[model samples]
Target: MPTIKEIAEATGRGKSTVMRAVKELGLRESGHANPDGARGALIIDAEGASMLADFLTKNVEAKQAAGEGETESSNQPHIDVEAIVSVYRERIDDLKAQIDNLNAQLAIKDNQIKELTCALDNAQDAAKEAQTETRRAHDQVVLMASAGVWERLTGFKGLLGPGSDMDSQ
Candidate 1:
């Protein structure tokens, strides 16, 4: 509990206003005696103080609605909305540019992938051709081995058969 004077000091209102609020709101005063067996002074509790605060806030808002609550802050300056919007637009443009750059990089990587795939296909075709040539060379070696041992021992030619290279020449 606090006296109306103390409440006025804490709430930044006059003591007369506090008393008027107590009267208007029908707030209760302290009734309990002190431990020294003395009666307490006229005071309102936290609940009554809270009611007074609400009552004051409503009155101020009502006055403001009636065009009478103009304060120093409201008289100062308005916010720069165009400047803020311009800053946001610049940020959006920067983000769009970054997205364009990333898209270009993605396209380059996609081209590289396509080129690598084409190179791999060409390498595989060359490897298959090399394998075919190696197989043909192996068959020639086998045919030469199958020529008669006598022809090899005597250093003779044209003795393998009609299909031999010497006969063809």
Candidate 2:
């Protein structure tokens, strides 16, 4: 005889699943006094467990066969191929429109990048020109100072005279 746990282990299923299978297969269970002080225990002989397993296997095979038959019958209904093709065509057109819109956006971005690059180049050229002008002005100031032009313009002769403290330097 096998307990519910032993049958579950043998069948690789839960106790409740084995019990349901036993019930569905109409297998009779023997009643025995519970060693753990419970009322009774329901057990199945080896022959009954084997019969239950066989019955469950046949039942599953039958269900699978019926499911396959149902699918075959369900697929026999007439399908409109033209409608499906038209739906796919519309989807393709929509995807093409999306591609065109993306291309337009990319073109706009490229134009903006080109404009920004041109503006950067112009700013760099202007900066170089400003540096050159600054250097020329500095050279003109040094030349005038060495020639005592500032002192002559201000009428301070002794301040920048040839033998004075400024000339000795």
Best by lDDT: 1
Please give the CA lDDT of all the candidate structures.
0.62, 0.60
Model 2, 1-169: lDDT tens digits are 5566655555445678767876666665332212232745556654454555555455556666778856555323233334334434545676698899999999999999999999999999999999999998887567556766666565545544366554554
Model 1, range 54-168, lDDT digits (tens) per residue?
A: 6655665565567656553554223233433443454567669889999999999999999999999999999999999999888867876887887676544654556665655
Model 1 residue 11 distance off true place after TM-score fit, in angstroms: 33
Cand. 2 TM to true fold? 0.40
Q: Which has the greatest TM-score? A: 1
Off by over 4 Å in 2: 1-66, 70-79, 143-169
In candidate 2, residue 71 scores what lDDT? Answer: 52
User: What lDDT score goes with residue 110 in model 2?
Assistant: 100
**Clash pairs (backbone) in predicted model 1:** none
Off by over 4 Å in 1: 1-78, 146-165
